[model samples]
Target: MSKFMVLVKQLYKQKVSAKSFILTTLLYLVVLAGIMYWSEIRDLIFSGDADTIAVVNETNFDVSEVLQNTDDYEYEYVTAGEVAEKLKDGDYYAAFTLTDADGKLAAKIESYDPLPLNDQQSFQGMLSQAGQIYAMSQLDLSPEQQQLLLSSEPIITLNSINEAAADGKSADEKMAGVWISYAIGIIIYIFVATYLSIITTDVASEKGSRALEMLLVSVKPEIHFRSKIVGVFLVALTQFIILFGGLLLLLRFSDGGNKWSIVTNLLDSMSIGYFLYVMGFLFLTIFMYLIIGALFGSLVSKVEEAGQVMMPAMMLTLVGFYVMLTGMGNPDTMLIKVFSYIPFTSGMVMPMRLGATDISAIEPIISFGLLLGTVLALYFLSLSFYKRSVLTYSSGGIIEKMKTVFKVTT
Candidate 1:
């Protein structure tokens, strides 16, 4: 037990202190910070008053009110006669001449250095909005009536047969399920991508260095394999806790959290049953992939073969992730239903089933059973060849190496 723990600790320390791990963790942190402060970052890039815009309104109506200074651009109301002077004097970045054409509002910028697409879009949108307000106000209506006229967006009401709408929690559950399913799927995909290399390198590189043979004399194969797996698992979990916990903390306490709070929405939507099922599927998926990675790692007789053997694992991740995305959008379709039973895809699909759809308990039970069975099967299969595969060296592709391992095990 002492030896086993020492091995685990050694592996953990090595991986956690490695340069790759540190860099990836830092990258995740930068991404998390960006997502949390996206609005502020966007403001810094696209916001702030840059240059003064000259606006000459030729219409009798007061179109100058909505043309006031904004964060994107500053507007200075000037007469049409001074447009040339302002352009030549470099007093304005851009000049707009607003005119009522055929009783409709039309504005055009002076032929000069054209603004960027975003600026042009914003300029046209403001003019369009100003026209809307002017057209609406001309009616003989009160302020309340005009406000109602401007608010034309529809609010959809629920009419589902489930108790989803009874406590006003259905919408929360529905939206949160979709959002978290994507989150869970993406989290699984990225961790697998990042740490699968760790798993492969730990086994393959050790095999290449001829260190495993000596190490096995002191520690049993099962203990060594299990320790390495556990060590990498802990490292992955540590990285996740840091990244996810930091994101949640920021999103909960930051100024943006008050308005754009995924943490709050996730809490409101999470039920005991859904939470348990999500965790079950999430663990099963990540665990299954970890073992597969170890299996692939063990297949590589040399460290150089590790990169060549990652294709199979990555292909599975891609297929599962894309299918999960499709399933979340339309959960009850036959495509999703088929993938829901697939062990690789179900971890992503089944959660969407339970959380997004109104499925009964029986479906998930059977789906989870199949997935658990697959994990168990993979565990034994990977364990059977692990000891031999590490020692077996060959001079062919990965398929040939696999065949050699299979023959030796049989």
Candidate 2:
């Protein structure tokens, strides 16, 4: 036990102190911070270039009162000659003429430079509102009558068949849950893929250099393997903590009006029980990947072969990631429900389903049992493969090596 602890500590230190690890951690923090403040960054970069629009009203409809300026646009009432002169001089970003056509109001928008879609949409909206107000005034309608005519009808309430379906969650909360589930799935996929690659590379490198032989003289193969798994797992856990902790701090200090506040609120609104269940499945999935990665790493006789050995694990992780992303859109799909029970995919699918729908407790309990059983079975099987293949020098591909391991074990 003491020897295993020492090995675990040694591996953990080696990994955490590496330049790649340090750089990757810093990059993740920087990127996450950038994403969190992207809206502010965008405003800082583009807000100064507010477009100026000239509105020429040919109809006697004093629409200038309705054409308000925003931070991104400045609207000015101008003459038709001014519009033509500005277009020729390139003095305004855009210009539009409001004229009476076929006994109704019509707008013809022209610009020297192409206007943004939002600016065009805003102008269209202003024209519509002004036309409505003019028509109401011509009809001699009261303010209350005008308001009633302009107002939207009451929204119909949506009721779900599932009586227990996210009973109290608002639309924003439900959408936030989908985003949170997606974010969590992406995080798990990244962490699992990254750490598994690290484990495979480390094990293969040591084996290629014959370091494993020398180390095995003092330590059992199973202990060494298990320690390496635990050590890499710890490194992943540490990175997750630091990255999420920094994000939390940023969220804490951020203005409530920021878009990232939505993400923070969604996280806070998540049930602890749901988080625990997802995490339990996630941890088991990580363990299964680590063990399988170590086993593949053990079979490789050269560092150059590490990527080939790790390809299948990478593919599996990618499949799970994409499937979970698809499932987020429709969590109640039969395909998602079926995949949620699969140990390889459950890590991604189950959490999304749980967050987006009302799942029975027994479903997740069964998934946990299956995932746990799969991990334990794979644990012993991987140890057997590792014990048999670790010391063998092979110049063969993964299939050939796997066959050799099985033959020797049998």
Candidate 3:
């Protein structure tokens, strides 16, 4: 046990050697900076409203009053002629033409570019409301009757059953669930990219430098291979924990505010107990994915071949990632449920379901245990294959050989 610990430490140090450590640290810093810069960049690019509109013959049926009533856009009344024509030339975004229809009104809006559907809907609705009010005032009904005809309930209203109700989770919190899914997808990519590359280069270097033959003289292949796997897994997990923990701390104190508190309450909607449970579940799944990825990584004979072998793992990760994102609102299909329990895809898929659904507390705990068991089993299974494959370099029959190792172990 002590020797294994020593081996693990040595492997961690070797994998995270000074040069590599500095490279990864720099990469992480760049990623964080890019994330921070994105929001600022969006604000800068989309800053303020350049929007201006022109209204013609607005007094008797003033378009400015109606448009301004909606608070949709800023408008200025303009007179018609060649001067008004040139004014409508290029400076204004849109022009509204209003005409009297006896006791009624008719109108049309023109814009250089096509107005967005949502903007069109809003502007048309405001015009409709104003027209309705004008027609109502012409009615012989009393003011009370006019109020009765015009008054209506808002489109949406919520009545809370619980005494404690929050404004609900912000867009950021709702998006955090999706973004967190994306983050797990990213974590899978990082692990697969970093350590698979490590294993490939390690294998290629070993074969190229004749290190395997020399190292085999003192240590068994299985011990060396398992030690490498253990070491690489530790390094990957450690880096992930640092990044995740740091992100949590950043978010906890973030003044940026919640992005989607409307969909659900950020704090009140989820029980603290389940949130922590799911987070723990997420960490375990990441560790499992790293281990399985490292196992497949050892079989590559050359550094270039590493990516080809990793395709299966990548597909598995992609399936989980997209399913979580696109299917968040969809009911659980058989495939999602199965993927949630399966080892390879569980890391990304199940946690997303947990976040979006109000599942029983026991389900996440049971799922965590199942994932933990699978990871432990996979470690031994992968180690057996690692033992057989790490020292052999022929290209054609690697998959067949892996099967043999599994067959023997089973």
The per-model lDDT (C-alpha) reads: 0.80, 0.84, 0.63
Which regions of candidate 3 fall more than 4 Å away from where they truly are? 1-49, 55-74, 79-89, 96-109, 113-210, 245-268, 331-334, 397-410
lDDT of 3 by residue, 1-410 (tens): 55556667877887777587668866785676556456666567766654677777643644454567222366767765433454447677677766667877666787877889987887688778877766776676797987888786556544446544433443344555544555555666566556655655565566545676786677776677666666766777777777766555544444354432332354454457646755666666656656665666566565566666666666776777666656455525666676777766666666665655434556666677788898788878877777766666556444764665555546
Most lDDT-accurate candidate = 2
Stronger candidate by lDDT (1 vs 2): 2
* Clash count for each candidate, listed in order shown: 0, 0, 15
Better of 1 and 2 by TM-score: 2
Model 1 segments beyond 4 Å from truth? 38-51, 63-68, 80-97, 101-103, 107-127, 152-155, 161-173, 256-262, 325-337, 352-361
Cα misplacement distance, residue 49 of candidate 3 (Å): 6.7
lDDT of 1 by residue, 1-410 (tens): 58889999999999999898899899888888887788788788887646788888887778767787766678888888877877778778888887877767777887357678887888888888888876765666787987898897778776657763333336557777777777888887888777777888788888888898899889888777788778888998999899978877777766745834657657666788777887888778878887887878878778888888877888887888888889766767888788889998888788877777767668889999999999999888788778778677776777898899878767
* Model 2 lDDT tens row, 185-288: 89879988998899999999999999999999999999988998999999988898899899887776656646466665777877888889878977888888
Worst 10 residues of 3 by lDDT: 255-264
Against the hidden true structure, what lDDT does model 3 obtain? 0.63
